[model samples]
Target: MVKYGAFVLFYLSIVWIVSSCSSSTVEPDAARLGYTYFPLEEKSFAIYEVEETIYSLTSTPVTRNYQIKEVIAEQFRDLSNEEAFKVMRYSRQNTTADWELDSVWVAKRTANRAIRTENNRSFVKLIFPVEESQKWNGNVLNELGADEYEFSQVAKPFTIANQPYTSTATVMQVNDSSACNMKRVYEVYAQDIGLIYKEKILVDYRQTNNICEGLGDIQAGVQLYQKLLNYGKE
Candidate 1:
């Protein structure tokens, strides 16, 4: 989890650059904007909870319920999957929760080229995991947690935790019906702590990205989930 702090640092630095430019007369170079994280090409490990029901404290109650999951991983910057998984397993083994491994995933790269309105070109790279079904031609629909999904072509503005951002040209590279795309929004959240750039899949829809992979033969899904939670933290 400490490693995630570095990812936070990178995001904070980006925000600083933006703020510094906004305050000064100097025009920022939009072309120079980009992001990269540790475990650069290795793999990512974390923990996740597949919720069974919707719990509400208010009288109105929630009309819908979805699985709740936790992903703790090294925040993107300069890190490795080994570092993330080691820490994650240690944490879980020491924690009080009776959590067990849910799934394990291998990292896959998905790079996208975006042309800004100002004619600035930037490339965004996302490293996620591809589940067994997505990679192999095995079970179709008969499985419980596997489903195909599609994403919107239009871009949308959203906030992470609370920070605000403008995410243009939305894309869905993964297809998992269990994942939610509407309630959760992918964005770049600029907080006092740092910048958190990730995809917040809706709680109802646990969709996966084509950029991700579930290659390794391990069942420690919780560890991988936690790794993702800490994706931007370290």
Candidate 2:
């Protein structure tokens, strides 16, 4: 009887351990996947103000300010019979200037992923079941090298231009810590608004040591910033 009781106690302990481990891995809610942040709805359009700075080794650095309008111009089925969107990009120097056709891109959303094809290159922008701190390869669909993408600030509040967003998700794409070269890229998407802000910086230190002394001096690189100025349907 003593040995049987001991065996039963060990069995119950093992069962408890297994149950604890299973419960710890909480299954993310499907409704909270953050797919609304991508907003593939037809007639969606977003305007963004762009500021770009270019650095050159032998020439003086230059900066340009402009605005871009991205509109969902068309929707069609891709080769795989998946729904795809054609995004038409238009650019203007200022509010009073005419919009010039800039570029064309494509985007699609699957049951498991949100993908955008820019310049004939496909990128897995977001994965379903958007759990905080979840990591995935942003370049999974493209030929580019593997890029680790992590989600943070999930469903967090963010404000821009005195406007408030209830929930936003930030994708941290690239953040290099090397001193000789620096590359930081990230994008912020607002729920029901698509992409709201972006920043990309890749610069090389100009000092004799070829290492970063500060952000002010750069040998050759580019810095780009895009912030949503307006958004609406159609």
Candidate 3:
């Protein structure tokens, strides 16, 4: 009877160990929890309407409207020995025009942060378990100037192109640096999707004091923006 009891206890111990191991192996649902705002999966794609405005101190502002289609083409390893996805961007003059390949970028996500490379410059795009008011030096690893990046809002409701997102975050450039030349960028991301909107503005105040007189104090600059129109994921 003693030996039988000991065997029963041993079997129960094995079962408990297995149960614990299985539970530990389960992965956390970052998407469902709204922890990861940018989901970078292959074949995932988004379409946006792009507008670029150039303001000149001596002349009138010029605005150009276009369409952009961004897609995750494939996966590859970046120079840092980290896994990354290749993103392709196609642009056209309008919705009725044909798209032309514009540029290619790379994006990588780790446990703590998301990194993206564009125009030969790499920067941290997002931080995991996103929290509002979180600040970081986005250009720290890039050896660029101390450009501050901040999460202005987290898990907020946002709407674009008639599509509403329950969980959205806005990341903004908050540093005042001469290197920026009064340039600023803002990016918005939606849960389970990727970038929903982006805006870049450059203000050149040295051109003329009366520049942009009706608009603001700036002399000359450019404003580039993109808004998500649709998205699909495989």
TM for every model, in the order presented, reads: 0.26, 0.84, 0.81
Encode model 1's per-residue lDDT on 92-121: one tens digit a residue.
332355555444322222232111111121
Number of residue pairs clashing in candidate 1, backbone atoms closer than 3 angstroms, sequence gap of 3 or more or interchain: 61
Query: Where's the lowest-lDDT run of ten residues in candidate 3?
Result: 206-215
> Over 4 Å off in model 2, which ranges?
1-31, 209-212
Name model 1 segments beyond 4 Å from true.
1-99, 110-156, 160-169, 172-234
Residue-level lDDT for 54 in candidate 3: 88
Global CA lDDT of candidate 1, please? 0.30
* Cα lDDT of model 2 by residue, 47-137, tens digit: 9999999999889999999999999977999888999999999999999999999999999888788899999999888888776898999
Itemize residue pairs with steric clashes in candidate 3: none
Q: Among these predicted structures, which one has the highest TM-score?
A: 2
Write down the lDDT that model 2 would get: 0.88
Candidate 3 per-residue lDDT, tens place, 5-44, comes to 9999999999999999888768666864444687888998
> What's the candidate order when arranged by decreasing lDDT?
2, 3, 1
